[model samples]
Target chain A: MRAVEPEIVVVDYGAGNLRSVAKALERLGASPRVTSDPRALLRARGVVLPGVGSSGTAMAALEERRLVEPLRELMARGTPFFGVCLGMQLLFQTSEEDPRPCLGILPGRVRRLPGGLKVPHMGWNQVALLRPHPVFQDVPSGSEFYFVHSYYGEPADASLALGTTDYGVTFCSAVARGNLVATQFHPEKSGPTGLRLYENFLRLLVLEEARPLPWR
Target chain B: MLAKRIIPCLDVDAGRVVKGVRFLDHRDAGDPVELAAFYDREGADEVVFYDISASAQGRGIMRDVVARTAEQLFIPLAVGGGLRTVQDMRLMLKAGADKVSINTAAVQNPDLIGQGAAAFGRQCIVLGMDTLRVPGSSPPRWEVRTHTGRGGGRPTGLDAVEWAVRAVELGAGEIVVNSMDADGTQQGYDLDLLRAVSRAVSVPVVASGGAGDLEHLYQAIALGEADAVLAASIFHFRLYSIAQAKEYLAQRGVPVRRVPVPSGDR
Candidate 1:
């Protein structure tokens, strides 16, 4: 008999790189379902919201697919949620890239990287880990991760930031609060160190879910 | 600080990796998938696969190659060559390519850049320019060339610097300045063209063509002000490994991503 792999849902809302994110999860031996359906998201053992592009369009795509409220509800209930790139920015209250309100799950606005610097802060940059986190477990602090974006999330409360990276101006690169986690960089595209990040996130999800309740 | 990217470009024809000198005289390298994985293992920052084949059937084969390659590596894969429309961009991106580079088609349509960016976002669109220096032009100016499909380099009469700035305005996230005069010569990059475009655009500029040695790569960044350097012969011919080139740069105060050690080596 074959062992059943946990079903991880990758939210697909017409944003780019869904397959890349799904393939990375598949490489880690998990069965990833790429879907825009809210029901699929709710039933997922783990949910990854991977994105590229502008926050305004992404928010619109999520709204068009009716995934906005469900994603918000999932995060509110402490679901194991991982957001990447624009997915990380969409969790904010608003984005300067497009004049649209984001999910507002986190209390902050996404702002453009300061002027006089190249936009889309493309290529590899080091993420300075603020404190130990499970998802980044075994990943060294100040390690470089793949990033391609023009704007970054600025949380109203500073403690939500998990890591920060510098370009012209230092900005929050990763954030975690309770079961929710997100990275401004693309761990799925960051090679081995990135693959390890996925492994850590998946391992933590599986271990926590496999624990038997005291009542049982 | 962002690490300067060292990209190994694989010019793919049909299904195999091939290299051309000044967009002529094709030389077979190896399988695209294997070569990409090898580069990834060697700690290459990113790999670019340009589908040099012109036939429609060849395009289909490139898609398959992209799909197979995407399954193996976790790093970013950028696919270019003959991509014309937003649908074409969508097809390549769907096939697992992180970015789609538009060249000849972009020069003809121009709106395709904005359309692809609007449909898929600006980060997915890369503007590829084959530039040649206008002979005896005062202060040295470069003009754009396209139609590289059949080894034919057609002059577009557009200034390279002005076009780069315009393309960025049309929503291109990155620009690849491939100097036709310098390509395949392995002498060095056309620093003048690279610097002109780099200084004009607010987006990241990649210097391509004519990287003979480590010094050329360093010159592309330090002097040329290129955000990244794309080389083919130096890496494909095994003259210099990505690790060696990166080590050369890192030692000279240029920030580069440290090559991750293998598990056993650790």
Candidate 2:
């Protein structure tokens, strides 16, 4: 018997720079639909909240499309969720880039990358994995991932931290709780190691098919 | 700490990758998609493709090129040249390009920079500034050159370093400072120009043009203080590869992205 292919929905909230993410998923045999419609969000086997802009604008885009509640509902229902960059930031309560309220699915404030350490933190940086999650299976402990963000999530609950990378201040790179996972780096642009992470994420979906994810 | 990036720039004209010398003397290098995959396997931090030919007919081919390159590699791909409108940017970004660089077009409409940053966010809007020293200026300052010199060159009085800061203020997340004076010269980078721009900008500055040897690349980082260095001819002509450049940078103490060292060579 063959396993059903995961139908991943890449949330499109008008915060462009998502095609790369969708393309990466397509390469791994997952047909990801880039959509803002709430109905699609409900049906997705996996949901990717990929973002690349200020939190205020990003939240406004989500609000305009009325996806704020449906996304929360998707998580409440235990859909395997993934968020990238601003997408990861929006999963938290609030952000320094703006006063807009986030999904609050996770607890934290997305603060600026301190006062100094290079504004965008652009380039490949090594991530030190703190936890042994399935997403990181077969991936090395100190593998490098491409990063391009000015702010990182500071989750109120320290246990959510899975990977941390240092600039001037060491910050959280990947966080997880149950089957849901999010990352501050752009895995799609991170070369083969990045592709491995996605491959690992897809494996999580495969695992979900056998065992429905438990609620956090 | 974030490692310094060594980016290989693939300047493409028509459908094939071409090398640009001083933004002129376009010569065939290889297929854009093939070269990009090679660079990715060799451990390039990122790959930038400038669609030098923005012909009305060549536009479709360029999009296909960007799409094809993105299909093969996971590294960041930035395409510039011939993008005059936000729709042009939209087309490329939708074609799997992570960033859309604006050069002559940005100079023509400065507001376009802010527009791109507003629409796509600052990170996607890269300001590609081509600079050259004012021919008869008393203080010998670098001016932003508007034309590719393929057309008659138009040098703006705007100082390159100051313009970089203004462009960032307007929403350019990163700046690529290409020295017109040293672009094809390959003697070395315009360290003086690079150091000046690197000091002034709060955002990351990509020191482009004039890379002949590994030492030149090292200086672009260590002395020039550029956040990243862009190379064309040397890599195109086989004088150096991105792997060798990274190895040399490692030996010189400048932190860079590491690739698995191939066996049997030092």
Q: Which stretches of candidate 1 lie over 4 Å from their true place?
A: A1-4, A212-216, B20-29, B149-152, B262-266
Docking level for model 2: medium
After TM-score superposition, what is the CA distance of residue A89 in candidate 2 from its true location, in Å? 0.3
Model 2: pairs clashing at backbone N, Cα or C within 3 Å: none
Query: By DockQ thresholds, what CAPRI class is model 1?
Result: medium
Q: Quote model 2's TM-score.
A: 0.93
What lDDT does model 1 reach? 0.89
Interface RMSD of 2: 3.1
> Which 10-residue window in model 2 chain B sums to the lowest lDDT?
B20-29
Instruction: Provide the overall lDDT of each model, using Cα atoms, as 2-decimal numbers.
Output: 0.89, 0.85
Per-candidate iRMS values, in order, are 1.2, 3.1
lDDT of 1 at B242: 91
Candidate 2 chain A least-lDDT 10 residues: A207-216
Question: Individual DockQ of the candidates?
Answer: 0.78, 0.56
